[model samples]
Target: MGFEQLAALKDQLAKQAEEKRMAKRAQHAKPAQNAKPAKQAEAPKQAKPGRAAPTAARHAQAQKAPAQKSKPVDPVVLSIGKLQKRFPKAFPKNPAPKVPLKVGIFKDLLEHSEELGLNEAALRDAIKVWCWGSRYWACVAENAMRVDLNGQDAGQVLPAEAARARGLQAKRQKTKNAAAQGGAAQQAGADQQGSAVQQDAVVSQDGSAAQQDGTAQEERAVQQDVAAQQNSTAEQDVVAQHDDGASQQDTPAQQGNVA
Candidate 1:
């Protein structure tokens, strides 16, 4: 072959090869371009919320849930518990029975508060709670002996103090009974209101039923009247048919007689 023809043939083959590569690349790229926009369209619009970060908020309460969560301990109660351990005789635990204490025992407790790691206010509150219980009042009879921290007798219970203790005990009991009665009365009132609502509902239902029954009776009466009217019309039609037949028979008889 001639050199010119050979060069032209080589150029044509190269152009064809380049076109095939471009076509294959475009085919591979088309699906990717279409899929990218589709994926963007399917994406969610709503913003994702952050996991709970603590903010200052406090509110609701319930009954049994309180038992599940621990409550803050009272400072006075903790102080009293410590004193009970140190001086078991003067501040005996429940079920063991309480003993009358010396009238000026607060002064004695104040002296020991520092060693026991108790503050003044908490210690004073503890002493008040310990002395104010029913068992302590029971032990405060006139002429009954008052004991020190070691259970040794220091003084006798005065008559005036004993009388005051009795008054306090009676007042506490009366208040407690009144509170219980109030709760019971509230519950009864709520029950009565519920019963009244139920009765009203029952009355409303019965009235609706009675109204429906009256309407049904009226419909039945109308149907009966229509049936009666139809029967009377049918009887009149039968009578007219009988009269026409008699007239035709009489005419035939007259013609026969005349002939």
Candidate 2:
């Protein structure tokens, strides 16, 4: 082979190698540029309204639902002061010291109403109008009422049977008093009858004794009069006999003389 032919072939080989390396570099550079455009395109897609993330919307909706789910205020839990301020006619003043001001008592009263087959609205109204206590919740407690004891609230504080028993005891005591009065009257009548019988006996004894004394005095006077009459008759008879004798003698003498 010739030297000029060898040099020309080597140059041709070197040029082909450079062209292959350049083509590979151009391919890699083209791919890098295309990746940047794709990232840009993806950013615009995220910003578009139609491509919004449903997960974020769902999370926001969940947060809003919790805020809206808070409960409302109950009407049966009204304060005495507030009730007096709002409706003075129903609630004249605040609850007394003995009255139940605890919230638990109010809840128990509502529960008791429910047990009696009352509705929530009915209980709520009763709390406003009937359960507004001054000295005690006695108006409501004695009639569907409540009380506070030992820092706790109780419903149906009074027992009906106990009240009835107390009433019965009072009635019995009254009856016993009446019976005692009646017995006293009967004893008084007996005493009066006994006194009357004793008075009658005493009067009869006095009358009988006086009659006997009058009979004895009459007998003694009659005897004395009879004795005196007998003596007088005897004396008169003796005198008459003596006088007749003397008169006989004198008459005889006078007759002799006259003859």
Worst 10-residue lDDT window, candidate 2: 250-259
Model 2 Cα lDDT, one tens digit per residue, 1-259: 9999999999999999999999999999997888755444444345456655888878877887755555765444443334445434433454423342333434544545544455656545545443322233233233333334233344443455224324434444454555555455455545555554555555556687755665555555455555545555554555555555544543432222112
Taking the tens digit of each residue's C-alpha lDDT, what string does model 1 give over 74-154? 887888889889999988887888888876677777889888898777776677667765787788888999888778898
After superposition, the stretches of candidate 1 with alpha carbons farther than 4 Å from their true spots are 1-71, 206-259
Report model 2's TM-score to 2 decimal places. Answer: 0.20
- Show the lowest summed lDDT stretch of 10 residues, model 1: 250-259
Against the hidden true structure, what lDDT does model 2 obtain?
0.48
Itemize residue pairs with steric clashes in candidate 2: 140-145, 141-145
Evaluate residue 147 in candidate 2 and report its C-alpha lDDT on the 0 to 100 scale: 33
Compute the lDDT of residue 160 as modeled in candidate 2.
Answer: 57
